[model samples]
Target: MTLLLSVALFGIHSLMFYLLKINTDSYSYSLLELYGFFTPIAVFIIIVLIFVHRKNKDAVGYAFMALTCIQMAANYFMLHPMLQQNLRPQKINFFILFALFLAMETIITARILNNKQ
Candidate 1:
């Protein structure tokens, strides 16, 4: 369920970026393009996690949580330069979306950890 929700959120975020014309610069465009690459890989990983989780919950759960953390870190690294340039509304929108994803990932991580105990 969490994997599905995460995928949905990513899809929504990507669609919002396209519909809003937020990728005005090369850097931002690159970020969006990176997401274009990442979303499918993430979906694949999450699907595999779902299957692995059914067989061996602990290891795969931890691995999935770690993958989410790595993804969040990558997001920060990609957005950091863009955030430094200016405070445009579109940039703010990106920040808000990033925060939303961060919150969701944190909550999912917490739930995974809680379930382990």
Candidate 2:
């Protein structure tokens, strides 16, 4: 789940670079900044998942649910700054994507937890 979120973020970052015509250096920096920002949280989740899986394999799905929450939080934080910026069409598209990702994450987390039980 964590990897999935990372991949999604990377993909979005790439798409943004292409569509926004942002400078290559700026695009690379933005990607690294966002990726670096999320790294510690993802590592913590992985550590917890490792420990939980070691104690009980059945709890792995719960780890994924936890990851969903973390990813959603990351997404929300990523956009928090954008919300203050002047509105633009691309930013609006990003907002839609953000909301859609959150909704999908909510559904995925619920399903994962339900199956875990």
Candidate 3:
């Protein structure tokens, strides 16, 4: 789960950055720079949570849930304002990713809890 989540997260972030470069209309170096900060912090937190809670798979799911919640908040407050746009494609995708991450985390947690019982 950790590996899969990490890959997904990396791929999305990379795609966003790459797209920003190719598209002049959506270009915002300041926003990209801020997102860069989030990228590293997210990676660090995910790695730490995965390793530190390796023995407990359920705990890993919880960590992902927590991270997703934080990411959602960051997306709304930091990313949204910096972009200075409403109803953009990138904004839509951001919410989609957040929902997907939340769903995955919730399912994982439910499965883990069931297995324990």
Number of clashes recorded per candidate: 0, 0, 0
The candidates, ranked best first by lDDT, are 1, 2, 3
Mind giving the per-residue lDDT tens digits that candidate 1 earns over 60-85? 76777677777768777866777877
- Which of the numbered candidates is closest to the native, going by highest TM-score? 1
TM-score of 2: 0.47
Q: Which is better, 1 or 2, measured by TM-score?
A: 1
Error of 1 at 40 (Å): 2.6
> Please, what is the TM-score per model?
0.51, 0.47, 0.46
For model 3 the TM-score comes to 0.46
lDDT string, candidate 3, 5-114, tens digits: 64666577668758876443553333345445454655555565546465775577667667767767766675556368653665655555456555655565455445
Local accuracy of candidate 2 as per-residue lDDT tens digits, 1-117? 655776777788778778977655422125555556555555565666566666776876777687767777776777677666665644555555456544544554445445533
Ranking by TM-score: 1, 2, 3
lDDT of 1: 0.62
Error of 1 at 11 (Å): 9.3
